[model samples]
Target: MVSTTTTSTTSSQTTRERVLACMRDFTSYQATRVALYKEFEEL
Candidate 1:
Protein backbone atom coordinates (compact mmCIF):
# COMPACT_ATOMS: atom_id res chain seq x y z
CA MET A 1 0.00 0.00 0.00
CA VAL A 2 0.90 3.67 -0.14
CA SER A 3 1.61 3.87 3.55
CA THR A 4 4.05 1.02 3.41
CA THR A 5 5.95 2.71 0.60
CA THR A 6 6.12 5.92 2.55
CA THR A 7 7.43 4.17 5.60
CA SER A 8 10.18 2.49 3.59
CA THR A 9 11.19 5.77 2.06
CA THR A 10 11.47 7.42 5.43
CA SER A 11 13.52 4.54 6.75
CA SER A 12 15.92 4.83 3.83
CA GLN A 13 16.30 8.54 4.40
CA THR A 14 17.18 7.97 8.02
CA THR A 15 19.74 5.34 7.04
CA ARG A 16 21.32 7.66 4.49
CA GLU A 17 21.65 10.40 7.05
CA ARG A 18 23.24 8.01 9.50
CA VAL A 19 25.77 6.93 6.86
CA LEU A 20 26.64 10.51 6.02
CA ALA A 21 27.17 11.37 9.66
CA CYS A 22 29.48 8.39 10.13
CA MET A 23 31.48 9.39 7.08
CA ARG A 24 31.83 12.92 8.37
CA ASP A 25 33.02 11.68 11.74
CA PHE A 26 35.57 9.37 10.13
CA THR A 27 36.90 12.14 7.89
CA SER A 28 37.36 14.47 10.85
CA TYR A 29 39.08 11.76 12.86
CA GLN A 30 41.53 11.18 10.01
CA ALA A 31 42.23 14.88 9.72
CA THR A 32 42.96 15.12 13.43
CA ARG A 33 45.35 12.18 13.24
CA VAL A 34 47.18 13.75 10.33
CA ALA A 35 47.51 17.01 12.21
CA LEU A 36 48.98 15.23 15.19
CA TYR A 37 51.57 13.55 12.98
CA LYS A 38 52.54 16.87 11.44
CA GLU A 39 53.01 18.42 14.84
CA PHE A 40 55.16 15.54 15.98
CA GLU A 41 57.32 15.83 12.88
CA GLU A 42 57.82 19.53 13.50
CA LEU A 43 59.19 18.82 16.97
Candidate 2:
Protein backbone atom coordinates (compact mmCIF):
# COMPACT_ATOMS: atom_id res chain seq x y z
CA MET A 1 0.00 0.00 0.00
CA VAL A 2 2.81 2.38 0.78
CA SER A 3 4.48 1.58 -2.51
CA THR A 4 1.31 2.30 -4.41
CA THR A 5 0.95 5.59 -2.69
CA THR A 6 4.52 6.49 -3.47
CA THR A 7 4.05 5.58 -7.10
CA SER A 8 0.96 7.72 -7.39
CA THR A 9 2.68 10.63 -5.75
CA THR A 10 5.61 10.40 -8.11
CA SER A 11 3.31 10.30 -11.10
CA SER A 12 1.44 13.35 -9.87
CA GLN A 13 4.68 15.24 -9.34
CA THR A 14 5.87 14.40 -12.81
CA THR A 15 2.56 15.46 -14.31
CA ARG A 16 2.77 18.78 -12.52
CA GLU A 17 6.30 19.29 -13.73
CA ARG A 18 5.25 18.54 -17.29
CA VAL A 19 2.42 21.04 -17.04
CA LEU A 20 4.74 23.73 -15.74
CA ALA A 21 7.20 23.05 -18.53
CA CYS A 22 4.49 23.31 -21.16
CA MET A 23 3.27 26.59 -19.73
CA ARG A 24 6.77 27.98 -19.65
CA ASP A 25 7.34 27.02 -23.23
CA PHE A 26 4.07 28.61 -24.27
CA THR A 27 4.89 31.84 -22.46
CA SER A 28 8.35 31.99 -23.96
CA TYR A 29 6.89 31.49 -27.39
CA GLN A 30 4.40 34.30 -26.88
CA ALA A 31 7.11 36.64 -25.66
CA THR A 32 9.22 35.93 -28.68
CA ARG A 33 6.27 36.55 -30.95
CA VAL A 34 5.56 39.87 -29.30
CA ALA A 35 9.16 40.90 -29.55
CA LEU A 36 9.19 40.13 -33.23
CA TYR A 37 6.05 42.12 -33.75
CA LYS A 38 7.56 45.08 -31.98
CA GLU A 39 10.60 44.90 -34.18
CA PHE A 40 8.42 44.72 -37.25
CA GLU A 41 6.48 47.73 -36.15
CA GLU A 42 9.66 49.70 -35.68
CA LEU A 43 10.74 48.79 -39.19
Candidate 3:
Protein backbone atom coordinates (compact mmCIF):
# COMPACT_ATOMS: atom_id res chain seq x y z
CA MET A 1 0.00 0.00 0.00
CA VAL A 2 2.78 2.42 0.89
CA SER A 3 4.55 1.67 -2.35
CA THR A 4 1.45 2.44 -4.33
CA THR A 5 1.07 5.75 -2.55
CA THR A 6 4.68 6.63 -3.25
CA THR A 7 4.26 5.80 -6.92
CA SER A 8 1.20 7.99 -7.18
CA THR A 9 2.99 10.89 -5.53
CA THR A 10 5.91 10.54 -7.87
CA SER A 11 3.63 10.54 -10.88
CA SER A 12 1.93 13.71 -9.71
CA GLN A 13 5.27 15.45 -9.22
CA THR A 14 6.40 14.44 -12.67
CA THR A 15 3.25 15.83 -14.23
CA ARG A 16 3.71 19.10 -12.38
CA GLU A 17 7.29 19.41 -13.60
CA ARG A 18 6.20 18.83 -17.19
CA VAL A 19 3.55 21.52 -16.96
CA LEU A 20 5.99 24.01 -15.47
CA ALA A 21 8.53 23.30 -18.18
CA CYS A 22 5.99 23.86 -20.92
CA MET A 23 4.97 27.16 -19.41
CA ARG A 24 8.56 28.29 -19.13
CA ASP A 25 9.24 27.38 -22.73
CA PHE A 26 6.20 29.25 -23.93
CA THR A 27 7.20 32.32 -21.95
CA SER A 28 10.71 32.25 -23.36
CA TYR A 29 9.36 32.00 -26.90
CA GLN A 30 7.07 34.96 -26.39
CA ALA A 31 9.85 37.05 -24.91
CA THR A 32 12.16 36.33 -27.81
CA ARG A 33 9.47 37.17 -30.33
CA VAL A 34 8.77 40.48 -28.67
CA ALA A 35 12.43 41.36 -28.59
CA LEU A 36 12.80 40.56 -32.26
CA TYR A 37 9.86 42.68 -33.19
CA LYS A 38 11.17 45.58 -31.16
CA GLU A 39 14.53 45.36 -32.87
CA PHE A 40 12.93 45.31 -36.28
CA GLU A 41 10.80 48.32 -35.43
CA GLU A 42 13.84 50.27 -34.32
CA LEU A 43 15.58 49.61 -37.63
Candidate 4:
Protein backbone atom coordinates (compact mmCIF):
# COMPACT_ATOMS: atom_id res chain seq x y z
CA MET A 1 0.00 0.00 0.00
CA VAL A 2 2.78 2.38 0.89
CA SER A 3 4.58 1.62 -2.35
CA THR A 4 1.49 2.28 -4.36
CA THR A 5 0.99 5.59 -2.61
CA THR A 6 4.58 6.58 -3.31
CA THR A 7 4.24 5.67 -6.96
CA SER A 8 1.08 7.70 -7.28
CA THR A 9 2.70 10.72 -5.70
CA THR A 10 5.72 10.47 -7.96
CA SER A 11 3.55 10.21 -11.05
CA SER A 12 1.54 13.25 -10.01
CA GLN A 13 4.69 15.26 -9.46
CA THR A 14 6.06 14.23 -12.83
CA THR A 15 2.85 15.23 -14.53
CA ARG A 16 2.85 18.59 -12.80
CA GLU A 17 6.42 19.22 -13.89
CA ARG A 18 5.59 18.35 -17.49
CA VAL A 19 2.59 20.69 -17.48
CA LEU A 20 4.59 23.55 -16.04
CA ALA A 21 7.34 23.00 -18.59
CA CYS A 22 4.85 23.05 -21.43
CA MET A 23 3.36 26.30 -20.16
CA ARG A 24 6.75 27.88 -19.94
CA ASP A 25 7.60 26.77 -23.45
CA PHE A 26 4.33 28.12 -24.84
CA THR A 27 4.80 31.45 -23.15
CA SER A 28 8.28 31.78 -24.54
CA TYR A 29 7.06 30.94 -28.00
CA GLN A 30 4.35 33.59 -27.80
CA ALA A 31 6.79 36.20 -26.64
CA THR A 32 9.14 35.42 -29.50
CA ARG A 33 6.34 35.55 -32.03
CA VAL A 34 5.15 38.88 -30.72
CA ALA A 35 8.62 40.31 -30.93
CA LEU A 36 9.04 39.09 -34.46
CA TYR A 37 5.75 40.62 -35.53
CA LYS A 38 6.65 43.94 -33.98
CA GLU A 39 9.93 43.92 -35.78
CA PHE A 40 8.23 43.16 -39.05
CA GLU A 41 5.87 46.05 -38.54
CA GLU A 42 8.78 48.37 -37.86
CA LEU A 43 10.45 47.23 -41.04
Candidate 5:
Protein backbone atom coordinates (compact mmCIF):
# COMPACT_ATOMS: atom_id res chain seq x y z
CA MET A 1 0.00 0.00 0.00
CA VAL A 2 2.82 2.40 0.77
CA SER A 3 4.44 1.63 -2.57
CA THR A 4 1.24 2.38 -4.38
CA THR A 5 1.01 5.78 -2.73
CA THR A 6 4.54 6.62 -3.70
CA THR A 7 3.97 5.57 -7.24
CA SER A 8 0.87 7.72 -7.52
CA THR A 9 2.67 10.75 -6.11
CA THR A 10 5.43 10.37 -8.62
CA SER A 11 2.96 10.03 -11.43
CA SER A 12 1.15 13.19 -10.34
CA GLN A 13 4.34 15.20 -10.33
CA THR A 14 5.23 13.91 -13.76
CA THR A 15 1.81 14.83 -15.10
CA ARG A 16 2.10 18.34 -13.70
CA GLU A 17 5.49 18.79 -15.30
CA ARG A 18 4.18 17.56 -18.62
CA VAL A 19 1.31 20.04 -18.46
CA LEU A 20 3.67 22.91 -17.70
CA ALA A 21 5.91 21.97 -20.61
CA CYS A 22 2.94 21.89 -22.93
CA MET A 23 1.84 25.33 -21.76
CA ARG A 24 5.28 26.75 -22.40
CA ASP A 25 5.35 25.25 -25.87
CA PHE A 26 1.90 26.62 -26.66
CA THR A 27 2.87 30.11 -25.49
CA SER A 28 5.96 30.10 -27.67
CA TYR A 29 3.98 28.89 -30.64
CA GLN A 30 1.46 31.69 -30.17
CA ALA A 31 4.20 34.28 -30.00
CA THR A 32 5.74 32.95 -33.20
CA ARG A 33 2.39 33.01 -34.96
CA VAL A 34 1.76 36.61 -33.93
CA ALA A 35 5.16 37.68 -35.13
CA LEU A 36 4.55 36.08 -38.48
CA TYR A 37 1.21 37.82 -38.83
CA LYS A 38 2.75 41.18 -38.04
CA GLU A 39 5.42 40.63 -40.66
CA PHE A 40 2.82 39.79 -43.24
CA GLU A 41 0.82 42.94 -42.45
CA GLU A 42 3.88 45.11 -42.94
CA LEU A 43 4.42 43.70 -46.43
Candidate 6:
Protein backbone atom coordinates (compact mmCIF):
# COMPACT_ATOMS: atom_id res chain seq x y z
CA MET A 1 0.00 0.00 0.00
CA VAL A 2 2.82 2.38 0.79
CA SER A 3 4.50 1.64 -2.53
CA THR A 4 1.32 2.31 -4.41
CA THR A 5 0.88 5.62 -2.67
CA THR A 6 4.42 6.63 -3.46
CA THR A 7 4.04 5.61 -7.09
CA SER A 8 0.90 7.66 -7.44
CA THR A 9 2.51 10.72 -5.89
CA THR A 10 5.41 10.47 -8.30
CA SER A 11 3.08 10.10 -11.23
CA SER A 12 1.10 13.13 -10.14
CA GLN A 13 4.21 15.27 -9.91
CA THR A 14 5.31 14.14 -13.35
CA THR A 15 1.94 14.95 -14.82
CA ARG A 16 2.00 18.38 -13.23
CA GLU A 17 5.45 19.05 -14.64
CA ARG A 18 4.32 17.98 -18.09
CA VAL A 19 1.34 20.31 -17.93
CA LEU A 20 3.48 23.23 -16.81
CA ALA A 21 5.94 22.65 -19.63
CA CYS A 22 3.15 22.61 -22.17
CA MET A 23 1.73 25.86 -20.82
CA ARG A 24 5.10 27.55 -20.97
CA ASP A 25 5.58 26.44 -24.55
CA PHE A 26 2.11 27.59 -25.53
CA THR A 27 2.67 31.03 -23.98
CA SER A 28 5.92 31.41 -25.90
CA TYR A 29 4.26 30.42 -29.15
CA GLN A 30 1.44 32.90 -28.63
CA ALA A 31 3.86 35.74 -27.98
CA THR A 32 5.78 34.93 -31.14
CA ARG A 33 2.59 34.73 -33.17
CA VAL A 34 1.39 38.10 -31.94
CA ALA A 35 4.69 39.71 -32.74
CA LEU A 36 4.59 38.34 -36.27
CA TYR A 37 1.05 39.53 -36.78
CA LYS A 38 1.90 43.02 -35.56
CA GLU A 39 4.83 43.15 -37.97
CA PHE A 40 2.60 42.04 -40.83
CA GLU A 41 0.11 44.79 -40.03
CA GLU A 42 2.83 47.41 -40.36
CA LEU A 43 3.35 46.44 -44.02
Find the candidate with the highest TM-score and give its number.
6
RMSD in order of candidates = 5.3, 5.1, 5.1, 5.0, 4.9, 5.1
Q: What is the lDDT of residue 16 in candidate 6?
A: 99
- Give per-candidate clash totals: 0, 0, 0, 0, 0, 0
Each prediction's TM-score versus the true structure: 0.80, 0.78, 0.74, 0.81, 0.82, 0.84
> 1-43 in candidate 1: lDDT tens per residue?
2445467788888789999999999999999999999999999
Where is model 6 more than 4 Å wrong at Cα?
1-6
Q: In model 1, how large is the Cα lDDT of residue 9?
A: 80
lDDT of 6 at 8: 75
Global CA lDDT computed for model 3: 0.90
- Overall lDDT per candidate, in order of appearance: 0.90, 0.90, 0.90, 0.90, 0.90, 0.90
Give the per-residue lDDT digits (tens) of candidate 5, residues 1-43.
2445467788888889999999999999999999999999999
Instruction: Name model 1 segments beyond 4 Å from true.
Output: 1-6
On TM-score, who's better, 3 or 5? 5
Using alpha carbons, what is the TM-score of model 4? 0.81
Model 2, range 1-43, lDDT digits (tens) per residue? 2445467788888889999999999999999999999999999
Position 26, candidate 4: lDDT? 100
Task: Judging by TM-score, tell me the better candidate of 4 and 5.
Answer: 5
- Span of ten consecutive residues with least summed lDDT in model 2: 1-10
| lDDT per residue (tens digit) for residues 16-35 in model 3 | 99999999999999999999
What is candidate 5's CA lDDT for residue 41?
100
